[model samples]
Target chain A: MLEQGKIDSRQAILLIISLVLPTAILTVPAITVKHAAQDAWISIIVATMAGLLIARLVTDLSLRFPGKTLFEYAEEILGRVPGKVVGFLYIWWFLHANALIMDEYASFLCSAHMPDTPVIVFFILGIAVAACAVRNGLEVLSRFNQLFLPLFLGLLLVVFILATKDMKVTRLLPVFDKGAIAILKGAATPASWLGEIVIFTMIIPFLNKPKEAYRVAALATLFTSFYLLVSILVAIMIFGPNVTGHWIFPTYNAVRVVSIANFLERMESIAVAVWMFGGFAKVGVFYYAAVLGSAQWLGLKDYRPLVAPVGVILVALAALCENIVELLDFLATAWPPYALSVFEVGMPLVLLIVALARGKGGEGT
Target chain B: MKKIAVLLLILLLTGLTGGCWSRRELTEVAIVLGTGVDWMEDGRIRLTVQIARPGAFTAGSEAGARGREPASWVVSAEGRTIQEAERYLAMKVPREIYWGHCIILVLGEEMARKGTGMITNFFQRDRQPRENIWVMVTRGEAKDFLETYSSLEKTSAQAAGFLERMKTGYSVQLWKLAEMLASKGIQPAVTAVEVKEAGITPEPDREKKSPPQKQVGLAGVAVFKEDKLIGWLDPYETRGLLWLKGEAMKGVIIVPSPGEPDKAVSIRIRRGSTKILPEYDGEYLRFMVRIRVEGDMVEQQSREDLAKPEKIKTLESEMADELKKRATAALEKAQNEYGVDIFGFGDAFHRKYKKEWRDLKDRWDEEFSRAEVNIAVEAQIREIGLLTKRAGVPEE
Candidate 1:
């Protein structure tokens, strides 16, 4: 093994929370509102169910092969060629996920704060910080998340508390106005966002309580969805469903309303800071997963050598999305059912079934 | 060592590239305190900005002399669009125009009447201008209003902003205007300003200096049909609008005392809130606006020991009647004359009957015009003034 590091279940859950919550707060609400209208919160709840299912598939598969990542266990279950194909697919998924997150981070910061600065600068700043965390390895990455999670959550709480003064409960009226089908359509984007918790497969092998992986994953998904639900609710309450749907980032706009006595106005900078920390962690985890998975697939002795090369490709991929509008269109219209469902759920569930059929690995100690 | 040289080079480079590309030092930037828009005769827009002079407030600066002019400068330029006008302004102004501190936006009557559609794009699209900044319309030229020096505040724009916060009228911030424009049934309402001669004549100056010049004060409200200004509401009507919107906090209301024909009692509104109840009976849509007010009697000219419970009750009823009349007048003008639903009755109706609202949303303005409005005001007189009766009046 190129790296020797162990993270307990608590760290694992925090990693997933940090990975999933920022996207939920920043981008998912607007996308969900566009499809669901006033019922966007319902869409998030439905998506949470789908996310919990994906988490179950991943944890169940990881438990079958103790102390082995998906990269190692794939070959054990399938033949070598097929295993490498699946491994490559996951590598692609990680790179694409990292690119999507980077796009969101860059677009938000550029549009909201630094309009004169190039989007590429934001990408460079983010990936540079994330690259350092990747080079430091998983223990450092988990610890980084553990330290920043409170600040991230604290800022989110403050935004909600300040915005409640302007919130109107009547804006949430006319429930089921669009009916369930529209809400289900809205569920696709957030379901994919929460399904991102399947990144736990890479960290599961290093868990101190590997036996409790299911419980931890379940709790993490529940907590992430809860945070997302409150955020979406507050967003809809502050900017009504009609206005929120039009905004590119509803939660950021909600934070813009955190003015108290004119002295504390324009405090969305705090939200931007929180996102920077959260974005770094998210990109770091995905980048780390990609590097580690590719190294394992290549049968390399160490993954550290691949981190920088892979980081370049990740940044370049992120730069491919021309602008915020194009990225949002891709996220809403294409990315969900195509890439997210296949990798986060399809491949993992298929692997679990094939492993069960072959009667391999699960019977061991 | 080579490493030491690299570190020192980085430190030197850090000094060279100090504050990024967009950084402008305070002295080098023109801080915009207010902005105004006017429709020029040549089919162009006149953009005016009140830029604060940084040296004016700094003690010991030559510009900070007590006898110097006011602490802000008003500049205007005309162009096809506001951005072009601003760029034109950039040509004349020495410092870069910074809009981060701009707290007030004023639209001239021509601009307001022709419509606010063209002028609002700069504020909406620009990242610098905040969304919560107060937006108002001036009775005459916005440029003239921006130039008038306010007696109370250092800058006229600062005075306008403070007036909005003082609850003299409904303050429509940029975001609220955007919200009103986006919503299905409501139209935007902006506070209005007028340049008036200062009521207080400067104490007869020994040197025979010019008397105090004209200053800007809150006039009323500019009511809109969609985004175009259709009419103006006087201060009393603006107060009525505010009462219906639940934004009326502090204002004086004078109502006729119970038995006295000429005398009246002035009540100070401490707090107020409004609730709208809508009833739909398959054909007609009726809205009941319930205004609840709590206030204290500030002046009683009747001198009848009006602090007595029955007198207070009578006073409360009289106050309620006065509020109802004002609210009803504003509502009638909005519904019948302008055919605009400025009070957001449609939103209230939508909240109560969502499905019905969808069917009615297309013809909402017509429906709103036809809908019968009932105004009910319940006022509570919490306390009388320092005295119960006039000093000379005999107690009965």
Candidate 2:
């Protein structure tokens, strides 16, 4: 057991929010716009709702095992072999998700700020920072989120305010131009980000108030959805659907135009600040979850010793994708509603149904 | 002992990853302030760059001591692709080229006429080019335009950027042009830069005599048919287009006084707003453009005391008529001559009638040419600057 430090409801909310918001806010606008066009904001709302539903499902399952994570409780619900298989799947998902996040952070920094720097540098440095936070345990990571999320949000709002000068309200018009089917198609990618809240299963055992976990997760999803909506709206209004759909990072591009008498310009540096720290807190949460969950599955007495090895593997996995275009293709077409939904929503849902059918209850624990 | 070991390990790691890998010092990089693209007669694209010499910016420096070479070095190279041309130019330059600071992109008339879509790919593909860099079309070779220098600004690029900031016409940034070209509902319009010998002859002065100077100024607006430049709109017509697009921040409109036949009153526009309403009569479509303009009378060459309530009202009506004439000329040219919807009327239609816009979107330019447009101008004279009546003319 890694120092049984407990976090309150607010920290849970911050942790989940930090985990899901950073990469989605930076990349979802372009992906959603590709399918939904002017109605991308509608897709975001639909995805947020789907995400909240998934969160509710995961919270319900975690509540069934008050003090046990998904790894511990899966075997209790299923037999040993099948349960280990499920545990391995969850471990693989967390590792994959962390690697993907690391890849995104590294590529965005490489392309946007320092083009000449090898992307491996970012992967190594990012994992190093994340490993340090993960070694400090869950409480430290939660405090990191609690401290930096507000600054991230504040700088985001400043960018939003400065971007209003170029925004055209009519750019968002012609709602439902591509019809309901297209909007739902656009919702898939963001829905994956929201469903990743299922990672909370590992953290719920450490929550001071596990009963309030569902409400906290819902609120976190709501806040993330609201920020996603604002980002997509600002991008669409400033750059329009045609540009936002094509540009790799439309929100950063919108912030790049925040030139007010030259003194208030280059606000992209502030955006970089948000991306760096928010991305750090984000990867740290996943890193903690992956390491802790793996240690628990392997029946280790402590999870801290597993952090560095797993962090190294994650850094290596991040380097597996050679270029940004390949990563983006995976994100747009392969990840959503497929690999992501299967682990993030499907597996947990299957566990819930089997547990209910088998008459397994948490009161005896 | 454990803490000391951990501290030492951290120090070793820091030394290993102290600085950003692939970092280039400022002295080793040449900053490109502006870029110009022209179509060569040999069927290749010529890329011209205005490289800012940082040393010249220092006072009394070798390059700036006698203004031997302004603050920029202009160079051009020709190749099939813009990147290829840039790579060719890179060989002749001494330092690595940095494009993040480039603020302006000038397209030559021939290159723009041939279609700017081909040359703009590198700019969009590379992350270095800022989306908000000023995009303009020059009347002649873009290389020649980049060579024109003025005494006001340190370099020609700075002068060009300052001239654009004056709001002579609508300023189209690279990304906005991209957006316009990509979207079917709207077309692109860029400011046109013209380099000519200074019209005013130099007077004898104590300073060392300088040769006749070449000045660069914004000529008008370059209207595009899809991605290709089709024609130009005169200054008044450009104002009309800006007014319709709600970008006419400040400009002057000279109208002959209603009471005095020969005397002209110049009204300095202070504020303006435009609203385009698409009216569908269930059978045919008609567009109504309502323009509201507020200005102050800057010059009244007549002795008529135009600040009087009745006189101001008459002037306002006359100004309104003049505005309508200008807007109608712009509308007619767009509708009849070029047959392009540069005023974004198609977007207005899209916002108003979403379902119907889908049907007409494909052939919007054709429909726009035959569509009925109604122009209504509401001009208000809010203030008469400094004087209530005429200044030099005898007040009768």
Candidate 3:
């Protein structure tokens, strides 16, 4: 197996945020608006709380086994065969997740700009760039995220300021118009996205200051939730609940209405560029995790050789995802419970039982 | 080292190509300034495009003529679809047709009456057209409508731009159309333009009489129900509709006394808002509409005393009653005759009572017709005009 490179707590936190937050902000608002109406933002808040609890559990698992990855610890805790099975399943999840992210990025680009260009070209180019980054190891990815994070946050703030002229705060009135159950349903999909932090249990061994891992993860989770909440609120204010639900990308459409004195009109092109940047970062992180997980599972000497082949497989799976409707349906109904079982329920319970039985429980380092 | 050099060469070549996928130079493309859509007798679509003459625009001044038609060109084509018509027009021209700069979309009365769904799909689906472009329906053939040049503006395209800037008139943009289409309980309304032949006095010296002069004016509004144009509202009714919809911008309202000739007051609108409250009274559903307006007095008649509070109160009451009367008449015509709920009553009900709407979703139109509406107008004359009294006021 490839020797793991050490990542500091700060780099790990940035990696998690760069991975999970981008797609969460871009995709959650439109999906939540359809089911939850004006209370969609509330659903995001609830989902964030659930995400925090899952983060705590995953971090606790990491503290139980210091310097050993989840793939290695599972065999020591459970029998070797079952641990291997779980390891293989996690690899499959990462591969599928990366493919879905790639599809989302390519499809969004196709709809917003360059409609005539084949989406496959974007998929191939995006995966190729991501493969190069993954080959450089986690340190390079983390550094790239650190460099671009400020730019991403600045663009978001600019979008908020420019859209203030059209924002109607009254549109958010009559809160909980649908009921509590709708909000709960809306929270389910985003909670799954947030729960992907379980991957941190595997990566925590790489952190230089393993003790500070929980604090960094919590901070990253908090920032991501706040960003997602702002995105939902902006979408609801620009387009009323009825119209927001109908749009595929309500935030993009909301930015399309940003006309500052007529000369600054059609700045949606800039929005498209920013969107692609964030999407690429997200896909890069996920693709790296998938390739690394595959190499670790296969017991290969190096993950570098596996990166290109896995990247091709991920792109093909993304192209096979039928259409937008099927992708959405899969995210809403099937993915959430599957993700909860692996990330939230299964991993945490396994670590808890193993830690109690071993009786060497004061947070291994 | 050899591999690195090969990669560097490939990168340099890629950069040298400039990597512009869909860029067309300004000179190589016919920048569509405006587009007009009309319906033909054989059920085909006729599209007229106003393309700017790039060379003439650069030359600045024509050598031979005084006006010279602003040095622009117009082309018309007919086909089964808007895209097909565009393709046909492209065949007659040497340059690529670009619509990124197109500012206006005009629909003729016949085409609008038949339906605007098909006409709007082209703009919605096309990547070149921006969603902020203004949409209008004309009262006559759209081709003839675009042919009319204005004396004040450089081209008919400039005239169309002026009309779009007149926010006081009934105006709708593409985003608003999309909202109306997506909304469950609302219909779309667009400004209407009409071409009327201007009477021209023959110049004895000129051999070529100016081809029958035409002028464009804002005429009524085209109201659509489920993408089909149901009916229209006259200019006065449109003003009233705008007031009720809280979209009125600086239009003047003239309130004339019943039996007194030349006895009228002109009020200029400053700000306005309309609130629709839906109430269920066990038997009949009723809507309570409250309109609040603030305006300045621009004209006065009958030598009414202005300094007294009671006199101001009387004037305010009279103005409010006049506004209510006009607004009620507009509502009555839309409700009783046309039976189209253009005022977004369904949206109000849906927002206020979501549970009830879920049950009454299918029969919304029926429920809207049966519902009773009460209108109340509150007008405040904040200030008198610069000339408080009429120009020919009697010397008290």
Candidate 4:
């Protein structure tokens, strides 16, 4: 194998955070409000705990087989054919996830601002940007996110301040009104979204400090969950639980209600611009993972050449999603447990069990 | 050489495609000032749009050149569906009607009584119409309501704009409509626009031909269950609903003191909040809504000695009772006659007692009507208007 460059533990953590957190910020709050009501924020906390437990299991498995990617280790532990089958399944998951992310960006833009603009335009633009980022390799992508993440965080804080005048604490009254079942059901979608952090297992062999990768992942999970919690709380406070549940984009609606004065009105356009950056970061990371995984599965020397073609496929698939309602239905109903089984509970558990049974125990590196 | 040529071609293609995708300029489109929906005599929905004549409004000279009325040009069309109506209207208008800037959507009382869902379908489906655009039901024909210009404001649009900004009176927006539609428990309520004869003053000569009459003022609120308008609330009741929803921004309240014919006090609401607590007792679900208000006295009608803490406390208790009376009256009317829970009591109960709400979901209307409700108000008199005592009266 050609010499593979390594990423620092911080870069790995940043990659995971940048990829998993933005989608949660945009979509999770609305979805949680639908089932959990005011306890939507608590649902996010539950999802985060589930995510951290999965991350720990994946990290433990990766540590036992240091310097080797999950794909390579699966072959040694479960034999070549079954491992290859698993690898193929993982690639399908990554590609489908990429399509879904692209769909989210297109739907949000179409609904929020550019009504006349064709959805295909967003698809093409997203794919073009994502393809370029993927072609530059993971290190370049990580560096770009590291530079933009602080701005993203600062923009969120600024929104919180602007919206303080309208925040109603009574909106959060009578917590857990719907019983525990509502919150548990609501946690399903966010937990599956958080499971996307498992992509770190595929990238962990390329980390400079593999020993610290678990801690980094855990920290990233906590930070992303906290950001999601704050977002859910703010959205509920601004729109009230009932209103928050009805709107397609609760955060965008919350920002729309932000009016400091006559001149400060229509501030939601600024949020749309900021969220576009988050969308780009999310798409770039997912596209990069898909490209790398495909190249590895096909035994290619480099992933750069595959980026454009796969990007085209993803853009096409995203546009082909029937409409906004269909897209939402797919994400809410079809995605949760399917994604949870594969990304969270299924693959990580299998790898950990295999590693323990082999008794090689932290010697693969 | 190939790379250079390909790059140039790609750049040219991008510019061409990008230009076509985003060709809408703000100036080229006629911003819809307001929208009115009415049920015609023929039973079809009549949709009217007040399109701002940008050329005429922006340049005062154009208004003179066209010999047209001031403010805006109105376009009317009729169809079974709002989308079809919009398309018909589009054919008659010179420029495309853009709803992005539309601030007010009005429904005639007839149409509101028939159902507002058909008229509101377009606003909900179309992405351009903002979720916060004010929705109102007019007592008269919606077109007439839109056409009535106010003398105090620049135009009827400006008058409607002022009402939206007031935020203290009756107001409901598109997103609130959606929330009401989605909530299993609560019914929707929106502001009502009524046309009052614009204080016609008889000419002194009495022989001159009478000029065209004008109408103005939009007060009261239309309450709806599902999509049908069921009842109406006067201005005071609307203010009561605002308090219940915790949406009261700034409004003056007048309370008459007992045994003093001229001792009515005017209070300016400064801050207020409401909390709904849901508790279940066996088969009965009881709701306790506690309202806390802080206000400063804006006017004192009597010569009662001012600067006394005990007197202020008396005023506070009276104001609190007034608030309770108004809130209870509003709730009773909404629940008993209208059979609508516009105060979001159902949503509150759902959040507070989820499992019990689930059991009571099917019979929420019955439960809502029979459910016990307690209203508690706490009003603090912070300051005594500008003057501590009534003007023109000497201090005791």
The number of the candidate with the highest DockQ is 2
Which lDDT values do the candidates have, in the order given? Answer: 0.86, 0.87, 0.78, 0.80
| Models sorted by DockQ, best on top | 2, 1, 4, 3
lDDT of 1 at B115: 85
A249-328: candidate 4 lDDT, tens digit per residue: 78877777676775677777777777888788888887877777777778888877898888887887787788888888
Q: Provide per-model DockQ scores.
A: 0.61, 0.79, 0.43, 0.47
Cα deviation of A10 in candidate 4 (Å)? 3.0
- Report the lDDT tens digits of candidate 4 across residue range B361-381: 777878888888999998998
* Tens digit per residue, CA lDDT, model 1, B1-396: 999999999999989996668887898999999999999999899999999987765665534446555689999999999999999999989998988889899999999998896777678767778777799999989999999887667888898899887767788888778778778868788888898887653556767766768888888888998789999888888888888877757788899887784898899998888998999987899999899999999887875677679988988998999999888878878887888888888888987887898899988999999999889998998977688676788656
Docking class of 1: medium
RMSD of 2: 2.3
Worst 10 residues of 2 chain A by lDDT: A356-365
lDDT of 1 at A205: 89
Off by over 4 Å in 4: A1-4, A115-121, A240-243, A312-325, A361-365, B1-20, B56-69, B198-215, B255-263, B275-280, B283-289, B301-314, B371-376, B386-396
Cα error, candidate 2, residue A28 (Å): 1.0
In candidate 2, which residue pairs get closer than 3 Å at backbone N, Cα or C atoms, i.e. clash?
A1-A301
Taking the tens digit of each residue's C-alpha lDDT, what string does model 3 give over B8-65?
9989988988557766788899988788999999999999988887765654454446
Where does candidate 3 clash, by residue pair?
none
Query: Runs in model 3 with CA error above 4 Å?
Result: A1-13, A170-181, A300-302, A319-329, A332-334, A337-365, B1-11, B40-43, B56-80, B154-158, B197-212, B256-261, B300-310, B388-394
Better of 2 and 3 by TM-score: 2
